[model samples]
Target: MKLQTLRLSLALGLASALLAFPTAAHAQPAEDHAPTLAALKALQANAGPGAGVHAGDGSTSWTLSTGTGTVNQNRPIQPDERFRAGSQTKTFVAVAVLKLVEQGAFSLDEPIGGLLPGVVTGNGYDDTAITVRHLLQHTSGIPTNGLPLPQAGPDGTYTLAALVKDGLRFAPAAAPGAAFHYSNTNYEILGLLIEKVTGLPVYEAVTTGVIGPLGLTRTSFPAAGDRAVPEPAVHGYRGARIGGFYFWLDGTVYEPSNFYASGAVISTLKDLTAFYRALIGGEVLTPASLAELERTVQPGAPGVEYGLGITAYALSCGGKAWGHNGAVPGYFTQTLVTKDGRHASVVTNAHLVTNVPSAQMMKVLDTALCESRG
Candidate 1:
């Protein structure tokens, strides 16, 4: 069977199994169940237009759109809207590296220096000591370039090497397996290493090896200054409070090159779901590599857990899921899938904020996805 057909068959089989066995009679109250499509739509409406939800089990899916505005002040968000997957792009990079490992091109424990000479950050720590495993697990002790949000300008055209060098300025905070300090620099370095080893640009390597195999035509690593927003993309926003006054700011179109492999891919809900289904279904990496990818290295804070390049969580409703969440300057997004890849993909676009609402919305969406397994 073709790969896509095989994946759908596996998903259907799993869904059939899950449906065949009903949950315990007294597990939880029906009133406290996950949100329905209507409920999710109402919640997004409350949050504001441009806010939306996409949920689907292997058998069926739904996209709930609410709010209004051109995704780029020019186009409307529709059923097929695409958006930057943001840090969720890390999962793609991680899978790519793992595939290379499976092919005998590299090893997880191999030092990164040999792969990309003159690219490893040179500081007190031995550059040769950091392994590909450390990069995937976010335990390399690499500090980010301190520039959390990139300002658009000529300066925005900085290269991946510049970003890695900026991160190297700071000494490693802890020993290689110590703890997790999320840093874009890790994946940026990984991207460079992929390019060095494959003799292809990061984008080309990922597209040929992963995206094409998964049939995800809607996803791509766009170039810098590409203002052509994907069709039906949602507009992202930012909110803040200053001197007791609350305000919302419009987010600019994300420059994919600015983030590179760390967080730059643009994809729609359908394509994103397709990619994860293929990944967890064992189409991208070897069985051993997939096991490594799903192994948790460090515990993410409340409501999340960190694996090699993914996040796992036990929903409040019940059951476990794997996937990642992402945020850029003007947008925030969450993607989740069941351990068996049978659950839905939950994505929401919100005005960025450091507040409780975003967190609450995530919880709602997660619970909804988990409980909707039936």
Candidate 2:
């Protein structure tokens, strides 16, 4: 089936699920404790028809998407909807690498050259200068070299190695460990390294070690040939200014293999939240490794720190939240988890538009959800 048709089908499914909820149910007191569900529903309601929210703590999880059959031209958004996670894939790769570290595959300080020879593109520093830690922490100073690949057509799959080769034109920005420059190439190489060390594909390693163990069945590494579509997947749209008129481009599906380890995973909010909780709660990595992941570097951004694959943001709520914010061509997603693993994750398919209703919806949901924690 065409990608757009698939998206329409998923959206319709979500809308149907949402409309199944009775609107005439007993009106609970607004002041009642545990307002996460109600707050999420309110956010969905405000987003108009075809909007949904899935929220939970350590105990229970709930999903709610509201609307009638195939609302909004058969493109209703769903709760378990899968979207391009973008840079959030970095965390998954980092976790996989950390698992290898814990299994005595390599030390954090071990040089990347020893793991994957000739993967580094430029040469201000030798392979000896770059370590596994350097790549994970974004201190490798590798220049970001992401090239937009055209979507799959009648041609076959494009391998990750081809994507890396396409990115090799750029030189390193600084000496390894000298500064923090966000580079998709860093994780791309890390993905290659994971494949090298494990003797399995990067996708296999992540699925077997991280996603499978955490029970995140909603998540997977999508590739060109794979027909395994995530249920309730949202169709991503991009609004572009062409000749002073704004036009929306529909049915733009990103090639996950092009993103590779940098931005390939597709997941639901519930699954993403569960993964964050697992990682932050020390269930995924050792306490020492987790500490290393949380350690701040002096690359010089106020309240911004790099820990392995995660980004640490000091929240106004007097705690540190770690995760990544991601923007693909047609999606924007943010996943934030406290040091203790409590978190708020939001994902939207509306992209490159001036007025983003998703952002407003997220803000409302976050304020209400966080206030409930108080």
Candidate 3:
């Protein structure tokens, strides 16, 4: 955290100086983005030791990476390296559900209780009161299981039903559609709905319905028993938590089942950027569905709002970007697509104590998209 805090100071200074310019005329030069990348690499080196950025508008694009994949290995982060997408997986799940809605297979306003019966009922949670739209919007009042990843061990695993049962042990956070509460349980339920309606595993449903159609060949959802990320993947690390002390913990490989539908896809920045642009550009979802995806309500996090799986962030620079950001133990990722199709995607191998992307990391995203606006 000390390292990241210092990096934040340097990054802000760099951002201030860079933004001072009038944003070089459109199509000026590819090197015009070098300063943004320099600031990003500096932040990455100090924050997580490894990171990459994929940025550009339709006319110009930049792919860059900084720091090493492994600590002290001198193996630099590659622009094409794969890593866990974390909760960003939600966008894919949401898109899949929305596709079903478009095909007349599911209705957003329909109560999940009617679709799954007694499966979602228990511990004071009334599934009958929660609708598919509520689940996607995180207005279903569902509480997270509240279990941290490390507690689940390296081989963490759980069935969707089991996770839901554990989550139900706590009463619903709010009445149905009462207010916004971001809950991993919400997406897990959507995963079940997909399974129920399509009669397929959540992974297969997402692959066939979302990933395949987009031709994201490098992206994949690992099975519960799988612990190894495919080759050319970046190794992730975290600050070790021992009795009141912190040390470096290598988080390169671990069962992804603990993340499940909430955060279990492996992908590169390239594929992520493409997916986000298509989603925000209305290539995958219908106008009605896209509207549902962009319609947002404050989720109690400052400057952040939640939509059906998608998130809208008001950039510090000016203008807003639509997409979701995610974090697992060893990775933090974000994809932001502007209204005019300018986009940026970021991936970091180091996660903070809070598991949230650092301000400096976010600044990089902000600058990349903001700089590309003109």
Scored by lDDT, model 1 comes in at 0.66
| TM accuracy, model 2 | 0.77
Write the residue-wise lDDT of candidate 1 on 256-281 in tens digits: 76677888887776777777777777
User: TM-scores of the models, in the given order?
Assistant: 0.80, 0.77, 0.86
Sort order, TM-score high to low: 3, 1, 2
Judged by whole-model lDDT over C-alpha atoms, candidate 2 comes out at 0.65
- Candidate 2, residues 340-373, lDDT tens digits: the string is 4356676545345344454455453454335535
Local accuracy by lDDT, each model: 0.66, 0.65, 0.78
Which model scores highest in TM-score?
Answer: 3
lDDT, candidate 2, residue 321? Answer: 69
Top model number, lDDT? 3
Off by over 4 Å in 2: 1-76, 121-125, 149-156, 227-229, 240-247, 298-301, 353-369
Q: Give the higher-lDDT candidate: 1 or 2.
A: 1
lDDT measured at residue 369 in model 1 versus the true structure, 0 to 100: 74
